[model samples]
Target: MRPIYRNLAGLIAFLGVWEAAVRLGLINDQYVPPASVVLTRTVELLGQEDFLRDVIASMLAWAIAMLAAIGIAVPAGLLLGSLPGLRTATTAIVEFLRPIPSVALIPLAILVIGGGPESKIALAIYASVWPILYNTIYAFTEIDPLLIDTARSCGAKRGRVLASVALPHAAPFVFTGIRMSAAVALILVVSTEFIAGASTGIGRFILDATSGGGRMDLVLAGTIVAGLLGYLVNDGLERLGGRLFRWHAATTTEAV
Candidate 1:
């Protein structure tokens, strides 16, 4: 079977089991609504303006974070990757800062930037930058030294060599990093919204839905929506990567 068909079939089978389990009282309906119930709620949420707005807020925050991260990481990666001296000089600082959890910084973010869009965006950018930066650096490192040397020997300037020989090879890897960061960016956005109790986003929607209690259905529904959002975002990026960089598509797909 095609992978999509297998995935669909598996999902259906899982939902069938869940529905049967709930109907048979193997699981408490009060705590865990059946799959049908949650799926209906997810569909309903798509039509509701409030939930849609929250989704949009989350997506907007993610988009801003991703754009900012890409803008910062790509150039920084190119610079650091090209300059062994600079890369070596900053290795200690980069290693020190890279391992700190962005979630761990939520408290600091809340205190410094407050529980606003800025705070969430800032946190998302911090979390999402690493993958792209590392990927870009790795991409530059992977370029064939012969290609660069050939360009230089043929009278190409440093800038010309980078722009021509290095960049094309790096483009695919940079895009792969972008795809990785895209998921991280979304996770950070939602996580910040939920933990910080931001005024908007899907995380807030889920929090609000469960605050009064006895709304497990709504909570699950919101969660389902969030999962779908993540899947769609990743899938879209994957397809785009495949189309834009056909030479690298197989590697990218396998990596993902």
Candidate 2:
């Protein structure tokens, strides 16, 4: 069977088991609604303006954070990766900051940026920057030194060499990094919204649905929507990546 069919089959089987477990009284239906109920609610939520708004708000924040991370990380990565001295100089600070959890900084973010979009964006940016920056640095390492030397020998300036040589060679790794950061950005967006209790977002919607409402179905439905959104984003980026870098795709297939 095709991979898509296998994935569908797995999903069906898992939902069936979940439904069975709830119906059989093996699990508390009040706490964990049946798959059918959650699926139905998820479908119903499609028509709800409030739910859609929350989704859009979350996506907007996610997009903003991801773009900001890319903007900052790419340039910084290029600079640091191109210059071994700068990379070495910043290694200690990068190591220190990279390991700090974004979630742990929520209180500080809230204090600094306040309890809304600004704080959420701050957290998401923090969470998403590292992967892209590191990947870009790694991409620079994989570049052929001979190619760079050849470009310089041809009287190409540093800026010209970077724009014409380094970036093209690094494009694949850079895209890979962006793709990875996309997922992380989404996760952080939702998490920040949920934790920071932002006025608008899917995370806030989920939080509201679960708090003292006994709305297990709505909660599960929101969760399903979030998961589906993440899947779609990742799949879309993957397809875009494959299309944008045919050489990378060919190289990967050959390796496989």
Candidate 3:
């Protein structure tokens, strides 16, 4: 209760400062509206049917893309990680593709997938898969060799060794990758919606606000909603990871 109150106080203070700055003309209200105006616009947007639909559409795209990324990247990463030669052979290709910005691929995606949900989801998948793959590979490679040797000496089959030894050790890294991918998924989702044009999502809301007669307040409001959604998703992922990877918490405490 104390922590919650403290956080609320801090947020209030920040908003008060923002409002003061804008009202005093210390900041350009035309470009950066007051916190009060933004908040008002946010409330108005909440009641808007089209805006609500856009939020739902963006969330649906993010969820589908994330699931697809996890399903594809995890198994591929595990296989490559278990096989040193395969990991080595694919290293260059993976490195090359991983750094390619998802935004850059929007044009190609639009052309191929069309300017719709498909393009957004495809872009999200492209942006997200690398984190899971890289983390899975890192997790597998970093496992203590002694455990592998012990499992082998116990007459454990390859599958048994992987199940008992590798998976447990790598689970934390896998989740970490997933958490990272969530952020990527959100970024790509919004970028695709924005660049694709006339897309029915928060990005479209932002576009409409910006272009529809200098509605800076609406733009700020839309941006605030996007930021809140991102923060909520990230917090949810963190909580989920903590629950699924209790061993990670134990290990951290032990190390400290």
Off by over 4 Å in 2: 149-157, 252-256
Name the regions of candidate 3 deviating beyond 4 angstroms.
1-9, 253-256
* lDDT digits (tens) for residues 1-256 of candidate 3: 9998999999999999999999999999999999998999999999999999999999999999999999999999999999999999998999899899889999999999899799999999989999999999998978988999999999998999999999998888988899899989998998889888846999988988878997999988988888899989988989888888887887775421
TM-score of each: 0.93, 0.94, 0.93
Candidate 1 overall Cα lDDT vs. reference? 0.90
Predictions in order: lDDT? 0.90, 0.90, 0.91
Predicted candidate 2: what Cα RMSD to the true structure? 1.9
Q: On a 0 to 100 scale, what is the lDDT of residue 23 in model 1?
A: 95
- Residue 60 lDDT (model 2): 94
Q: Tell how far residue 24 is off in model 3, in angstroms.
A: 0.9
Q: Rank the candidates by TM-score, best first.
A: 2, 1, 3
Show model 1 residue runs off by greater than 4 Å: 250-256
lDDT of 1 by residue, 1-256 (tens): 5998999999999999999999999999999999999999888889999999999999999999999999999999999999999999999998998899888998999999998899999999998899999999998888888998899999999999999988988998899899998888888898899889999999898888888785999999988888888899889988888898887765554653
TM-score of 1: 0.93
